[model samples]
Target chain A: MAEPGREIPKPTPETQHFWDGCKQGELLLQTCKSCDHTYFPPRPFCPDCGHREVAVVKATGRARLFSYIINHLPTPGFEVPFAIAVVELDEGPRMMANILECEQTPEALVLDMPLEVTFQPVSDDISLPQFKPASQSTGSGSA
Target chain B: MGQKTVAIVGAAETTELGKIPHMSQIQLHADAALNALADAGLTIKDIDGVATAAHNPVELAHYLGITPTWADGTSVGGCSFMLHVRHAMAAIEAGLCTTVLITHGESGRSWVGRHGPSLFPSELQMQFERPFGVSRPPNMFTIPVLRYMKDHDLSVETLAMVSVIQREWAAKNPRASFKDPITVDDVLNSKMIAYPFRLLMCCLVTDGGGALILTKADRAKDFPTKPVYILGSGESVESPMISQMADFTSSRAFKVSGTKAFETSGISHADVDHLMIYDAFAHLPIYGLEDLGFVKPGEAGDFIAERNTAPGGTLPLNTNGGGLSYMHSGMYGMYALQEGVRQMRGIAPAQVEGAEISVVHGVGGMFSASGTIVLTNSE
Candidate 1:
């Protein structure tokens, strides 16, 4: 069934493990064995060298806020005045997530602020990797 | 290589813009194509090439009853029509076909028969972007503008000036959707769709389409309309995802394509008499100006704030009011190209008197793709 407000991702064959890892409150990143490069958003092979020999390693869930926007428009799944942020993980990849547990303003959501990943279970099989200020305690417990 | 010569002989927009409840998405394409054909004094049988974005070339060709020898359907986004013009020029130069008709139409506001591209479950956008609650273009595009503001010291007031300058041009255009003068405070205080972008700063939700007829420059005089010669053209795509942009401050695709167009045209910044940088959002023109080498990085805001791009200014930009005040039917490149043709032909409603050369640049996704075209009236 489709979620009401926000768009949900249906995990594919190549992406099932990543979603499963999220449900367990873990962040998985794909690393190329040949080039030793780490990448995000889950792919089948190494995007760096086109190598089939790839491995999924657990990330440290550590990142720094790169950029963000406080979207005031009313979206279906999310409330208005939410901070949609792009954070560069310490492992050398970037991804988008909601900067929860912080004021959705330019002052509070400072750039390069330390961040850590937290999972929000949207469905039985899906758990989204959301982020919050690293100074704050981990909010959501592992399912 | 010698100058590759191609000319746009005919250009026309859909009959009604802004609110056209009568036409479907495909019908807009047909409407523009037929209008262009009539403008060029040619029949459907005369066109040997067909190219379009948003709709299938096969569908448009069949609908117009033209069996083109060459067809190009390069849909990169709003700038897709610019790529179509480039491809059509190359095809005509290579003797693949002649008399190419490039069309664009979209029910962006009405959403009638608006069949969007189908992204599979495994697609990058579906897997990554959608999951993050990135609902639409407004939210997705603001991700970069906010960063740009921080890096460039661009205040919200400076950004609002972009719309103010464009509205100044729109006031001169009789057909402009929003001709009334708008102030910077008006723009800043409007409903905030996203951070730093207000309702006035965003492109208007409009329903319309436009078409262009192109042929070799040598044969351009044979057509009824004055040929707007294609001096140079370039198109490029940096990434499909906005988050994966090369940088937040600038668009790599805009730089790549704009540099190529300038180099091919062999014209300096001084030679440009007019300009049309697609203003889907206020920040786009800022990026377009900087990336296209017209202005230095972080200077576009002040350039507009100083009233340099308004009518009678040294550089007349978005003389058709741009997407901000003009009709924006989703794919805005076609309208940009049409304005270039109008200026070159000296027939623009907001005519920049004695204008000789015009540069039309466009952005596809949120700085994800770009296409640039250089047009001139001189042989």
Candidate 2:
């Protein structure tokens, strides 16, 4: 089976720092230095105020499952019945990720459940940020 | 606001719908254009304006051997054609063009000479969405379905009824790709493409195209076919990304477009005898109903589940079976617009008796964009 992170996104000048942070086991996000506004899929300017002054800050790596779908369709490097979840970050934005370490079923994956970030190295050059139930303590570091 | 001056004088689909492996995507556009021209009893020379979705107007005009003073290539996804109709109305009113022809064609199933937009790794969709293993439409669309269901207290069975009701309409049309009636159980049991969306709840992958001709109402009598007057039309865009939608329970684009059309047309929902909400997926109509003010929020599920939109119901919906059972040529808006013109002309196969006014609405992406057109047989 292909690994879950089959397609590694090519980092552009704007988003290179985000990928670099993942490789170092840190979840880095951009915040506007002028407005103190944080955002994801990093850009140089603040999306809210269009300020050029921005800073990269380490995230709390805490989030909750906002919504998701159990996809039966086969995707590259993934099996069927996988959960495609939307996680609401503690910093107030949402991002998509695949949930791991839990059975991919409705009974187990509840909405608004606590989740924490776990980086999985899909390639020697890239490590993907994935999520799992926050209750699991071990293997919390880079996998 | 002078909406009654524009009318649809010509409308037709490709020579063969559902599947046409022999014809390329561009060829389908040419065929549908010729058929519409013939239906209007006019030659290509009569067209002064042209619009299309997916295919380029420059190529379409060149292929059809016509020169248009005004051309529109609004590629907003499936609802692109609806916007074309609205733009054609404005162009005609502003004297930019007199007679307009709008065409749509796609070889979704065959992939013959298909050259579509690509989502590169640097694109926002690839950078954020694709990384999450969100495979395709069924996967991406699910971002809203679960939340809508929870907000509305809608059961899975209520959503499946959308397919069952559309199939009921499909059974009456001979050209429908899937005519056999299917029960809600049949829909629920179909292989799940995504949670809350079974195979039946999803639209079909077929190859086809449709065309429309518009002219000033003063010239309506010159056409061979009866005119379907443009009562009102509206179009709007939310966000290109589905995740950025303002509300998961409702489509703001749908609400804005539908409200604008209704206000411009000055027609109440009670007067609409027929309706078509783009049914790319079963949940679309449910969203359309609430957003259009035809039903209250969290009530469209029960409204459809109680047989209000089924055949012989007070308000006929998707009288042509819709994308669920009729045909989805990738961009399904053209088919919906064709059915609207057909009903106004009083010649649809599943014709709604004494149908005077029809409202056709379409969604471009997964609630990313929307357009609404209101039509009437009377001047």
Candidate 3:
């Protein structure tokens, strides 16, 4: 469900496939075919090796809390005291997202804690990628 | 130290800072420009080059009735003004223009003739980060500090000390927005704007602007005001997205910029008597100190805690009370440059006696961009 007043991302030609993957419950990443370099936020060319040939890969949806802040002020559609976090995907890229299913405190949102990606559909064309604590059954991979 | 020496012959802030509902943004720029012109005994007709950020240089030139042969509208973020000074120095050296005027103005608080946030849906920040509820600077800029603290074993009290010591400097400056003294407890107990960042740790939202006039060192003596020579300067950018910053604990942009400035200036850390690191947030100075090689990594918090940067300390920092207590009209790089000039001229309210060399460092956006300038009163 889309949160009222929250911004909806409009996809560009390069990022359309990534957004398309999100709508179908998959997190997509781009990898360079020439240099085998991986990157995010969807660009046509590889940033590392400047290669034109790239491949789209599925992210494991598993991540770890890298860093964050518990914002107390209210913004457009966000409730006060929410955790604005940066999570490191197991594949090596880090992205910003909001933490869910946890208390908005340093004690609860410990750094390096295990997390898993969960998509929240904000619009028909866009679905925001968020994170939540990894379940007990989800075996540890990296932290 | 180029072929031609460039010096700042005039520098002044707006007639009034904090709040000015009567003046629009461009008017604030004009007011500061006129004040600086009057200080240097020059006029708009005398200026052959112009530079500014946020607002277009062409618009500013037209607004001020200056038909400049050279103009720069390099707007990166808050540190845009620092880049302006660096660019102006090179322009003057290359004989691109005889005299250069760099102006900065923003309606951060009063919203006088200011545009609202223009968030493009296709922009990287808007597309990836904004949807996650990272709204304002306090939330975004403060995100990496916790990781820094955790790595350094820095306590919250040490972080609060940054606000406390800067407040002490602000107490000395009558023009500072908040003059009252504050304790570490006070900062800790203040309203929580973001985790690990209290209200006092954040910069003030005010409306103001400043301007600088630079000319060849040979013509610098013709001005009424003393000249502060630009010895060296450097600028660099890392990443626009805060999450993608090379490292959460330190800024890659700060390191590159500071290193280049030091290399160009050929000055050692011990030679610097005064420093001005843009304190948009408390952690910036800590990062600035380490990245600038003033101190080792993970030691800035303790260095600040031990009163190394306070009044009567070995090294003075943010002598203008900084953005935390001083006025912050969005782009804070102008104010930092203004204070550096003041220190060089021996006229700052909290002046460092016989301070010959001053280094001013600034950060734009969320550690996304950086610029450093080395200023000296001695030729």
Candidate 4:
């Protein structure tokens, strides 16, 4: 069927952890101990080293603002004029995330700007992970 | 082990794409099939096999009126139907079947619409990515595109150049969605669909049906249609989903798919007279150019600006206006094949003169699934 409205897909057992971390305002990536390869969208095994010994690691939550957009037209479920980004996470997974606490424009945003993870509550079962300019979260607001 | 010479003897289509709310999916399929049969001057009874794509294959068989000696519903993104041509060639050479009709019919934009089940991973892809407002393909693909821009030092204006040129090429095509004039400023100023990406930078959602008829080279001459021989074809799947991708800078499947196609066709980049790339979005052609070795990695944006992919330009690309302009029809790959066949036959609206060789590339997924087909008419 043609998607009628803004429909968000639900997380399954395999992806619950990733979603959970986002709910709590943390960016978490799965790392496999067998070969030490980290990845996003959480998988069951180490795709590269082929190991099953994997665990969720608290990401440094630090990232570089690789790219982003400020959307104007809102999907049925989303607010309009929100910011989105492809954050290069410290754990090695470059994730598609939202950038909150800032205007959605090239002038206010700079490439490779340091960013840190934050959370926005969306629903009872869903909490979302967004990023803020790293300086704001650090309190010093410099460098 | 060696190459083959299969040609396009038939082509067909139905009405406009999206939400007709009138005809059943099978009716659309049959209409395209019937048109192809007429295009090739052949009858349904002349075919020995059928290939189906989109929502349901068995349903297609039920509606088509007759069963084939060989049947396929191989679904790979939209371009999969074109990949079927190569498989059909192999099957024909193996004496399994002849006169294969490969088709796809879907209307995901509006009435009588269809989208195959999200297939588990995408369900999670939508969930984990969206609530944070990482919704839709433009947002999903932005991160990698960002990485591409940063690592390569590509400016947003450079990226905009790709779509702008494509829109210009699409202007000649009556089937295209955004034939209106567009400028780099227009693309830059356009509202953002995702970060650093705007509406003009994306492809439109259209609804329609398309078909291709192929058979042995010897039998093709007898067919009423002009034959555009299929030289080589290849397919590849690098990742199941975008989230699973390790690198954001390049598409491994595109590289590998083109490699396989060139091997099968025994043609090189130099042999190509035109390139009918699948441009689901502007970046797609850029990726195809790099992945298929038309340009060095990170050089496509510059190539588009400095080179001519437009009419009267050095490069005769997407003469039918491409997917960016041509009907999106769910899978733009099928239409690309149609354009390639037309170009080789010298019958396209914006025909590429003396164009004997062409390359039609199709990508599925988010740089995750890809296929490449090389075609020529040396004879």
Candidate 5:
């Protein structure tokens, strides 16, 4: 029998665009047409104003390390002692991801450290959005 | 606030806690229900209303041969029972039901007759969080502690102290899963399940259940046991995703629920002689203390470290050893409520001397929801 793999998200109508954007290497966010409120894990309507009309906009893919834990338990398709983090996007929304390209230790993964989004395709349809320490350069587009 | 309206006449845990491989999940619920009924000197036929979490109220009511007029299956998370108690009070007052039975049971360790994990592929958590390797409560619930520590200058040693003190309380309780005294060094040196959270700092994964019976205050005296009156209760919810919590250092749900309960109860903090803050993890009580307004933000760590919540301290918090040192059967709110009722009745294993009022606060999910209940022995 094949070993179990990490969970892959199946996109609904509301979140298909977000997943599609990830596949194309563009991070997408939803902005309320009436209130200009941008949110994540997309839905058709705006969470703030409940406005059905909304626009899909590309995100800068920049974020900050808000909080995290270095999980020692071996999860499927994940290396043991990996950093499972909650990163606050520069756009003011937060999301969970694995912190990569950095030491999975408290001393190395400082809180509020600048980070940038990176995509790793887990399946043909899903490109999981993850994070790593930001480079010195500013305003680079999504990976 | 003016007068007592509802009272809990009976509260009991399953005949055995920690582990019961023979009993399935629903069987744990039934055992607790039967025990609580026996405690109150009533049978299933007397229950007009039913409420539970993790299982449908309809199944529980029917299995117990009850045809309840009212039923609620509010499964927000671990704190669902606290919300049920709050709702039962309102239901009894509004004449929706004369007597309500609230139950909680989980075969967390045994996993007997429990359903396998449900897969919702398109769910928000599955899409965003799970794919990134965030699974189970330890990783998800402990995610916010690092930020809380950074913002408040809390040391890891203080976090370890939470487990050490709670273990001291556990030593006094004969039923506690762990009774040996442990030191902060012991906690820090314990197996690291997740960063900043050692095995000792996490709650026990046990199989157990508990039930409570509530009715109008006027009819409470007819029960076989002493009645613990419901003075006030509150409940609220926040973002389902732990990552989207408004602030990592505090829970908005806890603040909202605690404030509402305190306001409705019309009782000052000083009036609370005993307290139970659901401690699924060590950092939870810290968050519970500060968010519940018992202490200012950034002070709960210091307050707990100073042993204010320890045995013989000014505030007897988690007199039942809490989830950290006591038994945590997945949905732990029922056990917390049971401890509150015990303290109010002055029969707790580690009873607080001269205890008059007790506040039981609980959190569901990964800071996803909260419920607060205040019980008083006085009318």
Candidate 6:
């Protein structure tokens, strides 16, 4: 699961759909049919009401800035000054995605800021679903 | 049955929190052990009992320069310390040993190379959740909170109130990582780290060392000015793996442990004045309040926010500051017992008023293992 330039864990069968969707440039989640409650990582069963029927759905790809950290540690392949956010997907599930394309500071990470999903192609097969300001679009500068 | 009362006589700690790369975990545990023995008015040579949770067994005893005839390390993670305290009390009352020492230290934060190759043990790591990019503690916790919101028909506003209450509690203690006054609005509007959880709800990632000493009730009185008594104890592990748990929405271990502890102490939750439930994440206390029977199952979010668990509130809790504001050392269970002792002695700076009886509970490995100890002033 080593992407030539990336050092993240490889996705397995249970998590492949999530990675595949990210590869296709979409944010996805699993919803339980019995309870109709949305969840993350697309589990095999409805976590609520003990139902086995679950379905995959594209998220509105819209999220609210839930909470975040201003990391100063210099890890290779990742920006030292990066903002990692837990985004509240419009569908009800919350996912951990980084907030990119914005000032990498505390001021840029106000709670409830509107955001849109963006993917970073770590390896050819896997692209992590990160987010950035909704007003922003796909441009080149990363850091 | 000889004497059903026990209390902490000493507590000690080392400063290697967050990232300590220079020494083995054993060496770090030793430093804290020596400090605690000194605090208890005893030397390492005087300690004949050793207890720990999930260690390499002789690692702690060998490092401390004392090999007790009795040794135990149950390794339940953060909750291990409180469980060790209860075990020490039982061993002392049975005359198995005198002057026991408990310790823990781990470089969990720094030892593992992120992205390169995770050094975290395969069995111990979050195998089920981490692969989907849900590697952090705050993310896993968000799921339960989402369900709690549904079960109670509560708004996100209810959860926001918890951050403010804990921030206020943290403000009173210098040890907490966050001390400024935060508001419900600030928390609700704050950045989401995970759905249903905000930045303020997460415990700061810290790696540190802590140790405590226990002696026979009479031996405790001989040295320390106020040796707190351990009134009652209880422990139960419902599920080994978090994902396999039957009820992810509510914690079963906390409920069982709290109920058993209340029964062991011959009193109800109503008799308890100070409540120190683990706050590994902010939602922990919310789940804890319900499990410990303080509030109904779905009332924790609101119960905590209305000042029900603050310094001057009805349940005045976690006076030394919790993992939320204080230190989130690898194993903080023992420190919880130490805080209980301090509160009962009226020595805590954030002391709950008239605190004679306190209920201290610990949650280990997410919501898997739970333990409780009731400590009170010597009657």
Second chain alone, TM-score for each candidate? 0.97, 0.97, 0.98, 0.93, 0.98, 0.90
Residue runs of model 3 more than 4 Å from their true location after superposition: B1-4, B117-122
Q: List model 5 lDDT by residue over B1-379, tens digit each.
A: 6357999998999999998999998899999999999999998999999999888788899889989889998888899999999999999999999999998878999999887431112268887888878888898899999999999999999999899999999998999999999999999998999998899999999999999999999988888887899998889999778888889999999999999999989999988899899999999999999998989999998899899999989988888888987899888899999999999898999999879899999999889999999999886
Q: Model 4 over residues B35-121: C-alpha lDDT tens digits?
A: 888999888888887887655666766677657788777776766776688788888888788888887776646646454431224
Report the C-alpha lDDT of model 6 over B309-337, residue by residue, as the tens digit.
77678788776667766667555676677
Candidate 3 residues B55-134, lDDT tens each?
87998999999999899988778888889988988887788998999998888889988765311122888789888888
What does DockQ come to for candidate 2? 0.60
Q: If ranked by lDDT, best first, what sequence of candidates would result?
A: 3, 5, 2, 1, 4, 6
Q: Estimate each model's TM-score.
A: 0.95, 0.94, 0.98, 0.88, 0.97, 0.70
- The order of the candidates by TM-score, greatest first, is 3, 5, 1, 2, 4, 6
lDDT tens digits, residue span B254-308, model 2: 9999999999998999989999999989999999999999999999988998989
Worst 10 residues of 1 chain B by lDDT: B116-125
The alpha-carbon lDDT assigned to residue A142 of candidate 6 equals 21
Per-candidate local distance difference test: 0.86, 0.87, 0.90, 0.73, 0.89, 0.69
Candidate numbers, best DockQ first, in rank order: 3, 5, 1, 2, 4, 6
Model 4: native contacts recovered, as a fraction: 0.56
Put down candidate 1 lDDT per residue, B1-379, tens digits, no spaces.
2274899998999998988878889899889989999999989999999998868899999998999999998877899888988899899999999899999888988888778741112277777787777767788877888778878899999899999988888888888999999998899889988776789988998899899999989988998888789999889988777777868899999999999999999999999999999998998989999999999999999998888998778999999999999888777989999999999999999999988889999888777788999999887
DockQ category of candidate 6: incorrect
Winner on TM-score between 3 and 6 is 3
Clashing pairs in 1: A5-A76, A5-A77
Q: Per-prediction DockQ scores?
A: 0.66, 0.60, 0.87, 0.41, 0.84, 0.06
Regions more than 4 Å wrong, model 5: A1-4, A139-143, B116-122
Candidate 5 residue lDDT tens string, A1-143: 11248888889888898999999999899999999999987999998899999999998889889899989877998778889999888888888988888888989998888899999888878887888899989532332
